[model samples]
Target chain A: MSPLLEVNELQIAFGGVKAVNGLTFSADAGEIVSVIGPNGAGKTSAFNCITGFYKPVSGSITLDGKDITGKRPAVIAATGVTRTFQNLRLFPDLTVLDNVRGGMHLYGGQNFVDALFHTPRYRKSERFYTEEAHRWLDFVGYQGGRGIPVRNLAYGQQRQVEMARAMARKAKLVLLDEPGAGLNHSEKQDLLELCRKIRDLGAAVVLIEHDMGVVMEVSERVVVMNFGKEIADGTPDAVKKNPAVIEAYLGKADEPVKADEPAKAEGPDITEGDS
Target chain B: MSDNVDTTRAPRRIGKPASRISRLFESRQLGWAAFAIAVLFPFVLASNYAMSIGTTAVIFILLASGLNIVVGYCGLLDLGYIAFMAVGAYTSGIIAKAWELPILFTIPAVVIMCILAGLIIGGPTLRLRSDYLAIVTLGFGEIIRLTANNLAITGGPSGIYGIPGVDLFGLDLSGPVPFYYFCVAVVALMVLGSARLGKSRLGRAWRFVREDEDAAEAMGIHTYKVKLAAYIFGAIWGGIGGVLFAAHLSAISPQSFVFLQSALVLMAVVLGGMGNTRGVVVGAVVISLLPEFLRDMGNLRYVIFGVVLVAVMVLRPQGFWPSRAYEPEKLDEARKGKRDGGPRPGAPVTTAKGGTP
Candidate 1:
């Protein structure tokens, strides 16, 4: 069977800058793939393109073999693709339960009339949402007041709430952008274990993480990106030994490697004075 | 991590038993108490003038509650809300006068007209961002008023007159006291309905859209559709208020639906608390009745009314009673069935983790 999410040759630009140039990656069901990149390597831009926050200038994105390229964000989300923002986009003024229930909207199973009338069906749906929200929060190990506003929670608790909110979507593919950023060491450990649990749910998981320890330990495969293109794609051990990956993360060696140099040349020539 | 960057989380407890005073102030009880006071107002001052003022306040509450759905909940600032009132009043007035139907029977037609107007106005403008939407709605409000001002069927500047009040069981409800009761019952129902909507799934969607449009979309909420739903609901509420207005006065005029009227209704929503229906109710009564109550101060009462409003805003920028993020604990009910105090006693329960043991 094909991969669950297929993003091929995705390209996006902001004025003169090519944020995501010819990036290609795929994640299969029950697999956790980590996209590790330096600052401005276009991981978020690629996420935006795949999620339809930004339309790509080129390339196609497919989920379950159907093209979802250029679809609206809501349409893409409804198609079983859900994501968490890098900056923790929980509704600050809404209760923690409401934030998680936001993800459960698609499955809430009641329309406006049912809600307005408070029919038995609406009550049942609301109950389902409430139970499911608590379940996901439990799954994410969130420790905070469920009824209070998320803005009143600690940063770590807020992060877990965001995780619970994303998981409540029950999407086939989950994209987490820097989920471990600003998390405590214990929280990071919990997040790594949570990644495995998510993958075990038979969903494809792609995470953009700056934490190498979490990425290497949790991801089944690591796709290293630099200059908006994949520089290395392999098992964590193999990728850790890739010279180009090291050079991208750290500065380059005095001598240049010629074999992998061709792939970088194929990307958009936005690096003005690289030559 | 900064000293004062809104790190307002106070670690205490979830599902804290509310105090007696706070419990009494819960939204549901507050709504009932407000309506009860409204029902009892005529007993204190049984004058026709007071009754008329009371009736107008009820209608104004309907308008403010309706606008709350749009501006307060959905975060769409509409400056042309009064246009909906004009459409409702005109539709009801013309139908009741020409076809000679009872004014109460004209409700369905008024609702239909308001929906059409909502679509015509909200469809294109909602696609624009907040500022542009506000500007376009301002223009749309004018367009509707001007359309009424020009239409000969509406009697142009003078508007339709001799409109019959609601007649129920051969009772001419046009008398001040009877009409006041009618307006109260209708406004109460409308307000209750609006509050019910505010607690529903669509209502949550509106708050989500208001808080963050892009994030709301990422969570699978179609921002455009939800926004339109809010707009239409708002129009329906305003239109129904118009029907009440026309019936109350037994006449309709273009002058009644002016930009200032829209602003005052908006002020009520802003002053009371944008998303809270009970707050909107209080805001409406205060805005409409404050000037009347201050009539003893003569011409200076307007300035005092303006000063009081400004002072309230200055003191409470969130409005008189802003919407809070406090959600009631339905989770506890679910948890009681699943988890009980058998294993972990006095262990300082923190995380609301729920799953199979």
Candidate 2:
């Protein structure tokens, strides 16, 4: 009955700089929530906190009313949470099918013993992995060679494989960090449709995206942030018209010559290479 | 997705179909043929030196296969792998002499001791990255050998002696010809087990960890535990190799488990190609027997062996038989028998280049 993922008063700081300060948000099953912010607004920092990549100094994160703050990343993911990185963080040397099978690790029916001995259960589980891999790739409309190393794929195809890998988790809550970045116009449209399809599959979808067109068209709700704090939260239409949200992205209306000069652009893009 | 976007697909070269020999290498029959040749080798060469070389080569194969699990599959650099072998040999040798039991019965205790050693070393080192792990393991390996060197329980520098030969229900397998067969059978089984593990779900998890640790963890693979598994499996294989070593020599010594020995084992893995069982096996055989074949060159045999290893590595760094493992779409559909083998309408054309396996 309650929201599936909830974050309250989450604060994380790095040395002298506070990356995310007292940020709060929540989402329920079968809903799409988008977080839009300027480059240094701590959207990714918040994501890193929730996914246990970085331990927050204060506040808590919960899934299905269970506290998950400070848990290990693997532990957090095991509780039905899956995400795609802003950059494609795929096993580049592995086949596309093997990359997707990575998500099914926790649910694999056989263990090391079965693997060593090649038991019937091992064969069945492997067949399951392959079939599920194919199914997820098809669902994402991936038409690349599933047997080749993903490094050889085009950048957009690589993103599709990353999506297929994340969706293969079948997690209850899916967080997509800039799923539309580097995508062509048509590919962006496919991603928009995929977001809705993901929501229709009874999972909560939280997206962090900079493409305003995709964000406005696909997101049911949008939360805006600037300088590590939430400035506004509402429907996409309402958030778009919010004066503060506009100021955070552009600058102050009246006298905005050089107030926030540098990061009036995109901020702290850690994934700068390996497209 | 629209098919109009050319940016979504990388143009690929469509190579000719794989050769017949390559297809043979891809099948299990090749493995069986190699095993058959090993089994029939004794018939062709019955000399004591030949049998000795044969058993030692089989043991080397076992050692290389085990190291492949850690270095090849999981990408963990282990510099002190021989320590596991030391633990196994000493555990079994000490137990056999003190308890007056057959060395065969010491298998269980040898496995347990190796596991404990694996945990001790892996617990601290698996937390670190490869460079630190390599140094730590190199240190621990020396620590293990020095401990064996000083311990009264291990007979100090003299090492344990009079290790009983493998006994099987009143049948003694300690004789040269019989023991060769024994080592061959056991090593074959172990090598097969390692290969089986390579293609399993757990095996895939290990490969994932090797390729990208962070991505693996984000996908819910406990990277630490997976790495520990690699360490433990490597230890067990090395330990079993040790037991066989003691049985072969009828004695044990710290000198047998040295850093150079570990390096040679690792070299076999690298030369054969990492993560490929067939390649490792071939590498082990070449590394172990090349010197004997070059015996006519006297001490120059060592120089020739080194040159050959360097040449092979430089020429084919990917290994003699690199892993080319993946099920093709045509093969998959043919196996399924559900769809008419025709290409579906609107399906994008995708090509598979190079080797097929």
Candidate 3:
């Protein structure tokens, strides 16, 4: 099967600091893959480059075998890629239903003339959107009030709404950034199931997670990064046994070194996920 | 086999039925209520002065509703929105005077001018978000006014005069009674259009842009183009309001497009409820007619009006009738049931790991 997404030698930088350096990975159709590392592991930077939020300094990103490098975020999104932010960005003041409907904007059911003139196409599209919005909310397992502002919901529920919004985009690849943050233990479990269910819909799922347990349990494949580079890539079991991956997490290799061994610092070993 | 599938989907079903009151308000029922009230308005006061006051109030509603699209729905701080109205007023005034055409016939020209003006102003300023955009719009408003004052076509400071009244089906709609009804009909149509647009897809895009521009873009909404759409719509709305204003006075002058006029329209939008059509209409009516009620106060009228406005702003910053968000019923009940009811089916099962995959 063709890879749903591919990134080769992706490079992103903020001034002199390399956020993502020479990273490469691919998510095949129907796979749940994860990029795990310590804080600032350049996971999100890579995701941004893939989703067109940040133009990569060098490298190529392809979706469904089609090159999509350096496109606008919306253009890339239209090519079947949707993502959630590290921080929930729900429309706080809009109704919950309206929030989900926002994701369907690209569907273009009616034009201004249709709306202003109350044409049949406008009515049909409006009805379709209303019905589809409810279906998406249900698919996300959101059992909250549909008419109230999203701001009134709890954080966990709000996260679900954000997920529903992204799901409504009906993309082929979904990127979730730290979805587990702030979610209660039970809610985290729900998120895991949600990820699986999302994958069952045949879209490739790529996530950035700090929780090793989630990485091992949910992802079919795991890519471990250290200092802006991929240090390990394989099945979860293989990545777990990789020595470089262990050192990236434990901060010390198994070998004993002399006290005077040349002190060396890696490029971007920033570790500090939002605990 | 279908039975099991239906059963599983049944539990996941979500229903959204708006409350009876909301449905009634959103439908033609509210329009009928307003119509009844409008029909009775002249009866409440038979004087020509009262009729004219009512006419002004209706026109102000049109203006406020237009501004609300730019500032309230799209969250664009358009300080120069009145410039569109100025364009419309001047365009119609010039056309009606020079060509001896009815003011109503000048509408197409007014719309074209307002749209072009919207494009010119919205194109550059929309690139800057929030505060800087506000400053640019403030300058834009002044630019339109100064241009009107300097341009020979606009009759300079003296403006234009002898603009003919609206002619409909060979009937002279020149009298106060006919003119008042005519203004009411136009305002009504504009209000309906504004409300309908607010519920459309573009309106959702506007709200999305307002809430979060980056996320909106991620949803395939072109934030720049959407913002421009809001600007152009607002300009069209204001332009129509201007046509009415010109026809009502049968003349136009640069003095009418002053900053004070812009401020008053903005005040109406804010005071009504930025995004609520009902609140905006009420706000415009109150702001326009409140001074008339205080007319007996003579010189103290302006003082009282200013004080009341300030007090309202301080007390109710959201406006007299703030727009209440329409909450989805299923989501509300689901949340309520989560606390009191049993665990929801299809709810994610948690693993030992603290992170959700």
Candidate 4:
């Protein structure tokens, strides 16, 4: 099958600094691929470009063979890519159920008239939404006060609500940015198992994660990057031993061997080995 | 981590049935009762001036509630809200006078004008967020007023005159009692619709976009669309209120739709709890009637009004009545029926690495 998403020569600049430079990658269907990089390594820049939050200076983004470069964020979202942020972005003032129901907006079971008139169709759609919200909240293992404002919940619970909201979108590809950042050990473990479960449900999962243990343990494959350039693309073990990947993470030592530079994988095949 | 210590999550047991007086005070049924009293109030009183004041108060209530949707629920500070009100009043007035149609017949035209006005103001400014958006709306309000002052179709400063009231099948709705009742019905519908919308999905989206645009968008809610919808709905509300206003006064003037009116409408939204419908109702009534109630004070009335507003704002920044604390019995019975426990214990009590399991 063709890859679910493809990015080619994606380059974005901010004045003098290049946030994402000549980056190219693709993620296949049903894969749990992790993008690993050091701080300020253009991971989020790439995510923003793909999600249409930032325009790439040079690149093409294709989803299921359709070009969707520089589209509006909502339009891009309609193409079946959804994401969560590094910082939890739950609607704090609204009830937990409302926040999750927001994910199904594009489903359009009811229009403005149905909402205002409280028609039978409206009631049916509302019931469906509440039931679906309950199911997803349950799936995420979010055991918090569902009726109250989300801001009232603890940090980890807020994170779960965000996850539930993303799941509510019913998207084909879920981009989870730093899902394990502030989560406790057990919560991180829950997240790992959840990613695998997400993959089992037939959606491609693209995650940008910093925790080595969580990334190494959960990802089907991993891509390593440094200074906006892809350094390694392989299974976890293969990437763990790749010299360039090592140099990217730990600086290269003096007197390095003048051997052949492993040719950069041509086209978007570079994303094949990354889980 | 605190699953074992579940004292906070304990459910409460009900005692005896609530008293009728207390129940009336607590439920929205009280608002309907007040509306009924306002409607029938003119029949009990013989004075035309009293009925007129009541009619004006009702119109003000509609304006306040409309404003509450944008400023209160959506967290948009619209200093130009009166412009929508102006558009509605002018559109209806010009149509009613020119075509000799009853003011009620101009409603569709009013609605269209207000929606256009909302888009014109909201489209460019909503992207600014918070204080900046407020300043832009203020400018737009002035722009509308200046445009009205310069335009001839608005009949210069005097605006349109002798605008016809509701005329239906030989019955005269022109009498003060009939007019008062009509105004009451209109205000009631506006208030009820606003309150209902607040509890619906669109209202939730407004709240979501207001609190955090990025988060709402991340949830796949188009924040811009939600904000625009809020603007349009709010405009429709203000437009309808303007229709009632022109009918009540039987004339329109550019002076009537001023910045002060916008400020006053916003004040009512704030003085009442911003997002709470009942609070807005109370706020609108008090704000409109307080000046009349203080008529005996003469010049001192303005001073007392300022002091009272300051004190209220200082004491209750969230408004006189914030949303009531969650009362399980008062909530939708379906949601209340979902449990024996108040809420489930926090997700199987994940053990912290160092803390007790």
| Candidate with the greatest DockQ versus the true structure | 1
Q: What's the CA error at residue A19 for candidate 2, in Å?
A: 1.0
TM-score of predicted structure 1: 0.90
| Comparing 1 and 4 on lDDT, the stronger one | 1
Interface RMSD per candidate: 7.3, 8.5, 8.7, 9.0
What residue runs in model 1 are displaced by over 4 Å at the alpha carbon? A255-275, B1-18, B333-357
Q: Give the alpha-carbon lDDT of every model.
A: 0.85, 0.85, 0.82, 0.78
| Candidate 4 lDDT, B125-163, residue by residue in tens | 888889999999999988888888889999888788888
Per-residue alpha-carbon lDDT of model 2 for A183-233, expressed as tens digits? 988999899898998887888899999877777788788888887878888
Residues B260-353, model 1: lDDT tens digits: 9999999999999999888899899899999999999999999999999999999998887777777654444433566554332112324433
**CAPRI accuracy category, model 1:** acceptable
Worst 10 residues of 4 chain B by lDDT: B348-357
Model 4, position B153: C-alpha lDDT score: 96
Q: Which stretches of candidate 2 lie over 4 Å from their true place?
A: A256-275, B1-17, B330-357
Model no. 2, DockQ? 0.37
Candidate 3 chain B, poorest ten consecutive residues by summed lDDT: B5-14
Candidate 1 collision pairs: none
Model 1 complex DockQ against the native: 0.39
Cand. 3 TM to true fold: 0.88
Q: Clashing residue pairs in candidate 4, if any?
A: A33-A275, A220-A275, A221-A275, A222-A275
Please say which candidate is ahead in DockQ: 2 or 4. 2
Per residue, candidate 3 scores C-alpha lDDT tens digits across B1-357 of 212212332221223234676556555577768867876787788578887888888989999999999988899988877899999999998888888887788999999999999999999999998999989999999999998889898889898888888888688887777888888888898988888888899988988999999999888888889999999999999999899888888888889888888889999999988888888988898899999999999999999999999999999999976767763344324334444343222234433111111
lDDT for each residue of candidate 2 in B206-275, tens digit (9 for 90 to 100): 9999999988988999999999998999999999999999999888889988899999998899999899
Note the DockQ of each predicted structure: 0.39, 0.37, 0.38, 0.18
